[model samples]
Target: MVKLNKKYLKPLKNFYVIGLITFVIWMLFFDAHSWLLHNDLNKDIEALEDEKKYYKNEMKKDKKAIRELSTDEGVEKVARETYYMKKHDEEIYIIEYEDSLLKSKKDE
Candidate 1:
């Protein structure tokens, strides 16, 4: 048993070696900029990149819609539907569905 203990504890008896080992362990696991923090920062970067891609696609779609709305007919159609605009002597009826009303009620 004494021989086994001496063999296992021989390396730890050197103060310089023990201090180096402790410093390495502390830097790897307990330092501010450790491996774990790097991994979390990488995940955050990936999530932000995905969000940037999604917003870019949405911006492209919005630009296309805006280009379409530059025409006279598109403007008139959008105005009539979105803002309930009507021509002179024309009556517009807005029909609200029950399901939409129920969904909005549930949201509230």
Candidate 2:
């Protein structure tokens, strides 16, 4: 009887240890909260990367405008296009978008 008990106890102990290790691993790496946090981190990383790209593009456009405005012609061109500034004899016309008209209709 003693020999039979000893034979079974070793395998049972080993199985318990293996099961505990697997459970610990699952809780750390594959559990619901762990998965949620991992997914959130991925989305945060993607959003930050998109923000970085947007800022890079804005900086590039700003730098190009700066370089152009360092000369007389670029500043004049930007002012005319953006602010409707013109030479003494020139005229300006402003065009409004249809969305603003629709928005006013909805509000009333």
Candidate 3:
């Protein structure tokens, strides 16, 4: 047989204690503004913040490329490498390995 103490059981039997416990349970699990919903919304905010940082970094890289392309030498270099452009007398010989050929085709 277990001995139950009246001191501990008194608070549990009180109306105020019961109402407080029910309120806490309702807010944590059943309310429209529940703890679980707030947690999920916080996770979504973190994911969007990460994406925003990634896009800002990509934008900086694009701005740097735009500045470089504003010069004739940079434009010529990109054209020769990316588009395989050449002067009338200049013949460009591009050697592609097996792996490089596969990657190039994948990019196209």
lDDT of each: 0.94, 0.88, 0.95
Model 3 agreement with the true structure over 8-84: per-residue lDDT tens digits: 78799999999999999999999999999999999999999999999999999999999989999999999999999
Task: Name model 2 segments beyond 4 Å from true.
Answer: 1-18, 21-33, 89-108
The CA lDDT at 89 in model 1 is 98
Rank all candidate structures by their lDDT, best first, as comma-separated numbers.
3, 1, 2
Candidate 1, residues 1-108, lDDT tens digits: the string is 999999999999999999999998988889998888888999999999999999999999999889979999989999998999999999999889999999999999
lDDT of 1 at 106: 98
TM-score of 2: 0.52
Ranked by TM-score, the better of candidates 1 and 3 is 3
Each prediction's RMSD over C-alphas, in Å, is: 2.9, 7.3, 3.2
How close is every model to the real structure, measured as TM-score?
0.71, 0.52, 0.79
Q: Identify the leading candidate in terms of lDDT.
A: 3
Candidate 2, run of 10 with poorest lDDT: 8-17
lDDT digits (tens) for residues 31-101 of candidate 2: 88676678899999999999999999999999998899999998899899888898999789877799988
Position 23, candidate 1: lDDT: 92
Would you give me the overall lDDT of model 1? Answer: 0.94
